[model samples]
Target: MRYLAAYGGENNVKAGMLHYFMYPSNDISVMPKEFLEERNATNHSNIGEKTLKKSIDIYWELYKVKGRLQ
Candidate 1:
């Protein structure tokens, strides 16, 4: 979390957090639909999509969840 916030803009990081909520924070899916609608709005360019995608690709092998940060 620290590393992500340090590298990814904090706001975008939160967006990612919500996107990956299935990890544990997935309860966010229950939030108002209006909020969930923002899911496609985040773009954490500083976090490097290449690296982020790689990490997620690996994690996706073990866990099947939905949502994209950008």
Candidate 2:
């Protein structure tokens, strides 16, 4: 999302390209076996939750700034 904002929001061509590159369809198929195993093991871990919360907080901050500008 930050990348999208940096490239001029979701509607921009560069943002679309960035999204495609960042989230390729073959991501899981190409991942290392050990990394996949570790991710599966930590599927329900607190780290994932914390990371998600942090991302939301950042987006919220950006949203507030946008609102103020408007």
Candidate 3:
């Protein structure tokens, strides 16, 4: 949590927390639809597709869950 937020902009902290909690395997799939939608719309450039991909990888590793994050 702290590591991911280390390089994040101050204003992005809230979004980062939401991102971590909303990641797949949290058993809250439908809950974060709006957050994901908003994030895709707003942070595409800031976080970028590559970063999101990396996030997916990290999520899998962190939770030890299988399947795709997309």
The prediction achieving the highest TM-score against the true structure is: 3
Candidate 1 accuracy as TM-score: 0.28
Q: Tens digits of per-residue lDDT for model 1 on 1-70?
A: 3325333654454455445542433243334456656663334246565666666556544443234444
Candidate closest to the true structure, highest lDDT? 1
lDDT of 3 by residue, 1-70 (tens): 4423342543344355446444533233333556656554232135655676566566535743235355
Residue-wise lDDT of candidate 2 within 10-39, one digit each (tens)?
335343433433444334223456665665
Better of 1 and 3 by lDDT: 1
- Candidate 1 local Cα displacement, residue 49, angstroms: 2.6
Residue pairs in collision within model 2: none
Candidate 1 lDDT (Cα, whole model)?
0.46
Candidate 1, which ten residues in sequence have the lowest lDDT sum? 21-30
Q: RMSD for each model, in Å, please?
A: 13.5, 9.9, 13.8
| Better candidate by lDDT, 1 or 2 | 1
Greater-TM-score candidate between 1 and 3: 3
Global local distance difference test of model 3: 0.45
* Deviation from native of the Cα of residue 8 in model 2, angstroms: 26
**What is the C-alpha local distance difference test score of each model?**
0.46, 0.44, 0.45
